[model samples]
Target: MSDTITWGMMLRKLPSIANAIPRLVKGMKVANVKDPTQTCGLGWSFEQATLRNPDGPALLQGEVVLTYSQVNQWANRMAHHLIAQGIGKGDVVAVFIENRPELLVTILAVAKVGAISALLNTAQTRDTLAHSLNLVAPAAIVVGEELVPTFSAVRERVAIEATRTWFIADQNTCKPPGIAPDGFINLMTACADGCADNPASSRQVFFDDPCFYLYTSGTTGLPKAGVFKHGRWMRSYVSFGMIALDMRPEDVIYCTLPLYHATGLCVCWGSAISGACGFAIRRKFSASQFWSDVRHYRATTIGYVGELCRYLVDQPPGAHDSQHGVKKMIGNGLRPGAWGEFKRRFGVNHICELYAASDGNIGFSNILNFDNTVGFSLMSWELAAYDHDSGAPTRDATGFMRKVAKGEEGLLLAKIDDKAPLDGYTDPQKTETVVLHDVFKKGDRYFNTGDLLRNIGFGHARFVDRLGDTYRWKGENVSTTEVENTLLKHPTISEAVAYGVEIENTNGRAGMAAITPAESLATLDFSELLAFARQQLPAYAVPLFLRVKVKMETTGTFKYQKTRLKDEAFDPGKTGDDPIYAWLPGTDTYVRVTEQLLAQIQGGKYRY
Candidate 1:
């Protein structure tokens, strides 16, 4: 193979490059412009698309399609209704609905009336659900009728009056579920009498104003709400929607990811609206039905996370697996091990892997279609050497952060400025924790990403692990993500979580992996698993302890929650009946932990 750049690759990217320049120029002008009336909010952008492509399909679910004109009218009517209910600028309207066109309609309607939308996660229940709703202090909540049961369970705790609760019928028949619960108003009935015209309040919305509050995935406790500014939303529209994915007006996007998250909301659906393309949405992701849905919509692009891709790959191979029309795939967390096979099997030509946090100031994109890399960042950023044990940046004698050389792993940081403003959490104190000052110079401030990444050549970087997830074992740093990715390459292990465990006599934390095997508990080849892991990993990186779980626990965005696992830390008493195996020192294979061995291990007898 040639070690030089190919002209064919350059030719393939010319169109995206050509399309990005003008869009970026327009976005910068919008971001910097001061006039609230001139800056285009989400409502303004949608209205523009409606005018240009009135009859084009805006949203799709099965055979149901909502044209841009129809969606605009729906949003207009809902906006009018919300304004009549006394919702306006600065008021937060919480939205708790599933992935349907109405969900987008409600959020867009909230935006049209210059009110902020609080996007609530649908997976949350009871206290978690109530806490999220009350955190934003929403003036009103638009609830889907299908989700009424879950909402009703925590409705009293949310503290919002029944009069302010609006019920949207997920099914088209809309009989208001026979009896309306408490003071809830049927939004379908209300929308019938409302006007389908743009609200005057939309003009008051500005680029700098808070557009919505996206909650972080609270693995340990209640999630923190992060403010997302309209300015940043517009920038994402231009970057990911227009430049990165570079969808055409004729293209359709198949989005299975939840709309509550930024990747699905801003990147996938927002890209479709920005390019005036069709959005094919699902209520939730289904590994079995994914390809069929893609084929049904003739989708040219699909969105994903790493776990979703892994699920798709784990299913039994069939003729229909790669028979879809999808040509482009977008999103983050595509592991290097699976990236090649996924693209080849699915016939996808472009994989735009991105790196960004919901509330963080920095973003990196695989704009050049580079393999196994997060690609180059357009904004200014730095990589500082980090201490694995202390969980902080390693500093020089002068008290400044030490910069890591190229090809070395370090914590990623982005300088805070007007262009790259940190729209931190709703709590000011919580926001202060992520901002670092006087790093390179006095008075200079930067946003800490809390992620470790390798600075590969030519400005490209590969994700190593999260700050706290990378643990020290045997005087070497062990990246949990790396170990998990390696374990996932095995055919039998469907999912895995790698963390550190406190062995009685261990110098540092010992590597342990909790896994969900593909086969029955009796059929899993433990010896094969050990050999495979040993082949792929170094001695220090290979997990010493193996935990077989019936099912793995995950957060809303499909991230493994390691807090409980780390807390348990190989303690048989806390882990219950889950089987634990240990690779003893000088042993070639793992053995089941007996009662005596467990006691001995806990009593500092093992030299791990």
Candidate 2:
């Protein structure tokens, strides 16, 4: 889709804007970031919802359903149990659970006690798990039944003691005694005799106080724990839930994304609670079972990641594709290439693609249901000219960064102030890495988003690419995201991971792509594939090397594992069984790269 919004399109969206006025007013009242007197947090929001819709379905996972009152009371009981175990305000409790009602219940319980729930990535194990555990230094740990084995393996390496170790059964145990491992204490069982009343500590939980510690998806390296404060979650509730979806009690948001992530935990869940709506969660995403689950829940909305949408689109067109009640979607990374296809296929009215880092203050939401845009931000922000090589904002002779052209791609910078405060990573040094001091003017601070965006029109902008992900090739810059999106547009390419690779004698990095075909690589048409990339991309932007694989590896959050792919490059030894294809210089067709040909190419046999 074009970044420019035509007059006709703007006129069409005028009605949507008109309809959003009341929501905007109501949302602003709750979302007063500048108001010092205002105090909003997760527990406060949940308790308010209990008053509004006590009997309504608050959470659903398969046959297990929890009402607002039931969920609140259960969480309260667990809160008392935790307090009894000597856990108090600001203490970190590592919640190690998969997608389940109990996971959320545990988080709520911890929040009510004014303790921080360090949402550990369930995918983590061994050394990585120990690193994350030791980093947070959780005073207590909640291990899910399914994940016990994994956690048990690394338990010896961690610091927490058995007295503080908590466990939740795979099944509901809130009302009855549940079985626990020898060394583990059943959280639900312990809470059975505790008070079910709302804790006074919930009200004391301030906006600036850290509510949860969400680990960043470790795509580039070891994951960093990013602070997710109550203020941020409340902002999401008012902005995404109250304003964007205006979720009603009848609305049920089906989420298949990992609950540990902000997109699922805060954005989707917060939205549901904001309107006293139902929230349905699945253990993990299954593309084949996705639609079935949606239909089962009678979901009115969905929480998605771009990859999930792509997987659904990749599913063969069936009669039941558009046979669901889903009207809205809220999440991030729905690529422009697949946005239209997803909308057209699924028949969802609003694809509210959002843009926000767990560690960053600024957030953009597609409240107007705009196509191909991350939508708009009300926060003070700027698009600044940047140096791709250094991956930093480029400043002028006056030592001030200039704003990018209205429609050009630039590094996104969010102004850090009293209203838009940056509750960054746990490590002070890591947080400092993202803080841009004296950005536009003396004494002015900006949160370097490290993302490139195109300012389309109004307050909306289209996501371009990650700052470091864009490669300088030849004399021009090439965006890996743009290239990957272009590759995905092809009918045969099921998955595409684009990155920069260094050639032995090349002036700069060359564009390379690792793609997984729908069928075997034997049937893939090289000429057609080359033509598709050429038609959609520039000469420099087109990948010089193409690696065909049966599967594409991704992180827990569904981001491509580019670090490993870049290391393998186009070498047979490094890539193993995966076949490498290359678009050689002066060649019209892509050819297989044998060890004999690879030597010649790397020895500067031909000019690129």
Candidate 3:
């Protein structure tokens, strides 16, 4: 990608630049939070939004439309109910609900009570789900009726009392009373009797308090609870909403991403709230109907992931692709290859791509409407030389890390200081695992982002790849351990190692596993293994390709030689004695991947 800023691109961005100046000027004033302990938090922000436009459209889902007053009043009632239940500041409340109006209201209510909302991933089940719930030790849990069955399967594994289990009916509850199954309290009915006035706790809550515990995939294969504070929320409220997007009251943001994730909850929804604009949502994303929903909501901006863009671009051309009203977009993981196709085909003007981790201290915004870059960070950041073989940073003769030259891929690190603190994770040890000390000078500290980036000109950088064992696929980070753990449960598999390999036209890596059969390769049932894998793991986490080998190669430390496996990939020619197999998209069984089939798959014949 060219690092130079062309005059034609500048001229094309003239109108957007003109409109963004006022928003950026106004946003920078409130974006500064020198003293987080002294500033108000989420409750204050939401209340201010309600006060801004009481009757303006706040949320739209399906045929339902809620005003700012309606949502605030609903959340206020729930907040009062929470206080009655002995829940208050610093308490953790596990919110086990899918993407819906109830999920947002539950979190907002928890915010008003000054409690941390532990947003549970809906795709998780069995052991993974139990680990996340027990990690936080929530004071209470609010479950949507849709997820009650899934939660009930593992309720016995948690420590919460039956009475403390709150449930919101799946059906719309216009009436005061709603139905709930046994061992579940109807949260809506109980809260309906409470006062609908905003609580005094809103002002009492400060920026340092925890607002949400969003999960990120851990190297150990389990999810880690990343602490997201109100102070960071202030950054998102300003950076994406006020500075980058600059949305108006009439603008509606159509977000189809999951609410439990940072990009959807904090960035997209927070930006909508910052402008007091309409926030439209759906339970799940469907590429086929994406344009129809955008048109129906009249969304001016849309939330997207890299894979989402690829899916849309993969669809057959249609008039709605370029006929929609969407003019702007805000999200991350949009690949450079599909960026132009998505923008040109959809008629979007500005792609306000953002870069930030739920647990890290650094953030970047595309404020100047730049292409193929994360833009720039407001705080101190460094791109240091990395040792790819050992997966560590390189040290110079002085025993200090060296900075990678401009236009080179290097590991990204952020300074940890009072100005920009690393919020870290629920587990202190896990948080400490990411910290690097004495990088440049003695006693100096930095947070390792575990990401490689190439520094372009103009203080901007382009994202390169994620380091270590974990790789992202289907917009979700796939842990090698997680996939390997699930693979071990198969009777025929004695050993397994998982890694991601790049496909020809795909945005991110595709999951592949090298396995050793317990008996002979002919004795193993590929169909049975595929069935077992699909049952044990999420669809995205399941390995797409399988390589059968008699002996698994390892390093001197007994670690699987994943680098070799990744380089060999699923190509049968590369694996001399070992045979390779592939589970094609929409297929139930694995088939032998020969040279001819590999060429056909890579030549755009298959839609994987």
Cα RMSD for candidates in order = 2.5, 1.4, 10.9
TM-score of each: 0.94, 0.98, 0.79
Tens-digit per-residue lDDT, 492-603, candidate 2:
8889999999988877799999999888887799988998889889989999899999998887779888989999899987898899989988887799998988898899
Off by over 4 Å in 1: 1-37, 173-179
Best by TM-score: 2
lDDT of 3 by residue, 1-608 (tens): 57655577777869877988888777766766676456466777788888998899998899989999999999999999999999989999999887888889889999999999999988778898899999999989999888998999999999998778999988775445577899999999999878999987877777678999999743336889999988889878888988888877888999998889888998899999998989999988888999999999999999887657755876789876788789889888776766777788889998988789999988898888788888777778999997755558889999999998888778999999876788999999999999999999999999999988778766777877667776778877676766875786676876788998988998678899999987789888999999999999999999999999998874211246677788889888899989999989888999999999899878878787
Can you rank all candidates by TM-score, best first?
2, 1, 3
Cα deviation at 568, candidate 2, in Å, is 1.0
Reference-based lDDT, residue 19, model 1: 68
Residue 248 of model 3 has an lDDT of 76
**In model 3, where do residues sit more than 4 Å from their true spots?**
1-22, 36-39, 218-220, 469-608
**lDDT, residue 94, candidate 2:** 97
Task: For candidate 3, list the clashing residue pairs, or say none.
Answer: none
Clashes (backbone N, CA, C under 3 Å), per candidate, total 0, 0, 0
